[model samples]
Target: MAKRKIRGTEEAWETGELGRDEKYVEVADINESTIDEALELQMISIRLQKSLIEDFKLIAKINGIGYQTLMRQILKRFADSETKRLLRECVRAEEQEAKEQRQMEEIEESRKRA
Candidate 1:
């Protein structure tokens, strides 16, 4: 097989001779978990409205990305913002509880002194 530079714009690619110089190797010990870990990706499935999916596809095309990638980005952003908001609410509640406890302690101390 002759090794030639592969060009996408060439007419010869349509003749199905593009990969003639390519080499193929088989791996006997492939681990899916290792591949997923290396890529930091997890597979998940969820059902969505067909209209929602069509909207995403249009928006993704306008943004020059696949709809799935756009969905992932939106999910990530929502999760991050929601996590932060929940954490802040939790902290505020804890602070308010602590303040009320201190106020009760002050009232008890005043009663004891009287």
Candidate 2:
């Protein structure tokens, strides 16, 4: 793709615009990628009353983020944190205790089938 110089009209620097500079810029081809992950079960059901929906939109607009994108990022971050915490706890569990006992029992049961 070819690159071209673009002048910034005053409207480009409007309030709540993200990463806006006062000077004109030369824009190149935009490179963006979408995440591809297996679909998981939906976990949340949200009910937004009229006033609450309005307030949520207001907050999102002020922060210069799309409401849906903001929510997706927030949930992804929280889930990542929770998964890390659970993994850490699992790694710290006692090998000579309940975990070892459970593993031994499973092996014994498998041997009986053979």
Enumerate clash totals for all models, in the order shown.
0, 0
Supply candidate 1's per-residue lDDT for 10: 59
Enumerate residue pairs that collide in model 1: none
Q: Which ranges of candidate 1 are over 4 A from the true structure?
A: 1-35
Residues 23-84, candidate 2: write the lDDT tens digits: 64576564332222234434467876888667667878999988766677777899999999
Which pairs in model 2 have colliding backbones? none
Candidate 1 per-residue C-alpha lDDT over 11-106 given as tens digits, one digit per residue, 9 for 90 to 100: 656676564444653555969988888889899989999999999999999999999999999999999999999999999999999999999999
Candidate 2 ranges with C-alpha deviation above 4 Å: 1-55, 94-114
Listing every candidate in turn, what is its Cα RMSD in Å to the true structure after a full C-alpha superposition?
9.6, 11.4
Q: Largest lDDT belongs to which candidate?
A: 1
RMSD of 1: 9.6
